[model samples]
Target: RLLNADDPFRKAYPSESPYFTDMGMNTTIKQVEKVDDQTVRFHLNNIDAAFIQNLAMSFASIQSAEYAAQLLKEGKAGDINQK
Candidate 1:
């Protein structure tokens, strides 16, 4: 949910989130595009070293759109990362 502006997870960011900016998120990220099952694309407003490092953070995992859609269809989207 890193690119989700209104995601509740953003409000619960850890106090010591080093890769985060004073704005609470790396606003430098302009967009994220899923190229395929094995590839993705990130659009950035500028080159920020911290953004690169943010990829290594535990929460930076790539989510499966197909799985997300399945959850939505099943009315259990909130189960993401919980199970």
Candidate 2:
């Protein structure tokens, strides 16, 4: 819900941001599933050797969708520092 374009957060923010590139969402993510309230599953289009490592990077930080939506609502979305 957060990463997909169907949500307002993804729509407000660019798919590829300077802070982090959503490589899987851009290339390898064939599908996403909400397994439970605490879990989400990613179905990759192909094998990715660095996928786990990339996900562990600080650049891959997850931001609050509500905050992002608020930023966009206030027109302060672009004011966010990528890093």
Candidate 3:
């Protein structure tokens, strides 16, 4: 939901902004699909060998949709990206 036109795909690096791009989300992820309650599918831009390893990193943590939606409703959407 966050990867819409307002935040479209673009290259970013840790040096540029650690809070936003240390894990290279902009260039690496092509799309995301929630297959089921326990599974999520990621459409990657390339065959990344370190994809799993990258996901193990702290920056790759997934946020809860409920909390995100709540924040959006409360007009605190900007806070969602403040990690």
Off by over 4 Å in 1: 5-26
Which is better, 1 or 3, measured by lDDT? 1
User: Would you estimate the TM-scores of all the predictions?
Assistant: 0.61, 0.57, 0.61
Name the lDDT value of residue 4 in candidate 1: 60
Assess candidate 2 and give its TM-score to the true structure.
0.57
Per-candidate alpha-carbon RMSD to the true structure = 4.5, 4.1, 5.2
- Candidate 3, residue 54: Cα displacement in angstroms equals 1.2
Candidate 2 residue 36 C-alpha distance from true site, Å: 3.4
Q: What is the RMSD, in Å, between candidate 2 and the native fold over all Cα?
A: 4.1
Best-first order by TM-score: 3, 1, 2
- Alpha carbon RMSD to native, model 1: 4.5
Model 2 Cα lDDT, one tens digit per residue, 1-70: 3345565545545654433344544576677788987777878889998877777866556666677777
Given candidate 1, what's the lDDT at residue 64? 73
